[model samples]
Target: MTRALVIVDIQNDYFPGGAFPLVEPEAAAANAAEVLGAFRAAGEPVVHIQHVSADPEATFMRRGSHGDEIHELVAPAAGEIVLQKAHPNSFLGTHLESTLRDLGADEVVVLGMMSSMCVDATVRAASDLGFDVTVVHDACAAPDLEFGGTSIPGGAVHAAFMAALSDSYATVVPAARLAQTH
Candidate 1:
């Protein structure tokens, strides 16, 4: 079975001090870069999913903004596949399914921004679309949440999401483990 790497929304807007900063965005970007490198080395397909917010007031990532561009630290290679998406789920109204099909990909390694949202959405969507999904926990981030008048730590949210996701949508694994799998 062919496998592809789906990098979702590693854009400038999601980085620290950017439009919509996430927890440890820098680290996520670094791990994602390593994942990309591994995929390249293995001659596997790499798909870069760029999310552009159609909503103007949506923190950052407005259409045509620099924030919508791929983060400098995790830039894609010349021939890497790029899919521009308007929604959190990469498959929503996008050519993601067809693109993956054309590449003959039966499995996908997913990594990117906003662990509790886009990352999760993509994983679920991929699973629904019949792809074996592997989500790299260390290569994803989420904003801190607030519950019962207390701010939930980013790490807690990240871990909780990973635990939940492992049950159904995807197999949650550390970046190192996923990298070594190739």
Candidate 2:
């Protein structure tokens, strides 16, 4: 079975000094880049998913904004697929499903920013689409969340989401472990 890598929303807006910053984004990006290199070296298909918000009041990822641009860390190189999406679920209204199918990929390794949002959404969607999904836990990050006036730390949020997705949605592993195999 063919395998592909789907990088979701590793944009400037999630990094420091951008619209909405996440915790340890640089570290996450670095690990994600390592995974990208692994896929490239193996000559596997890669899909870079860029999210652009249609919401006018959106704080980040607005069209034509530098913050909305995919960051240089794992920027797309020639021949790598780059797709723009408008939703947290990368496959929604995008060519993601067809692209993976066209590449004959039965498995997809995912890693990206905002672990609780895009990463979680895309992993579940990919699984529902009948693809084997593996998410690099260390290559993902999450933001602090608030609920019922209670604030959750980013690290805790990241851990919680990763835990939630580990067995049900995808087999979650750290970038280091993936590096050894790739």
Question: How many clashes in each candidate?
Answer: 1, 0
Relative to the unseen true structure, what is the C-alpha lDDT of residue 99 in candidate 1, on a scale of 0 to 100?
95
Clashing residue pairs in candidate 1, if any?
115-141
Tens-digit per-residue lDDT, 1-182, candidate 2: 79999999999999989999999999999999999998899898999999998788888999989999999999999989999998889999999999999999999999998899999999999999999999999999999999999999999999999999986889999998987886
> lDDT of each model, Cα atoms only?
0.90, 0.93
lDDT of 2 at 124: 95
TM-scores of the candidates are: 0.95, 0.97
| Model 1: per-residue Cα lDDT at residue 63 | 89
- The top-ranked prediction according to lDDT is 2
**Which portions of model 1 miss their true places by more than 4 Å?**
none
Q: Cα RMSD (Å) per model? A: 1.2, 0.9
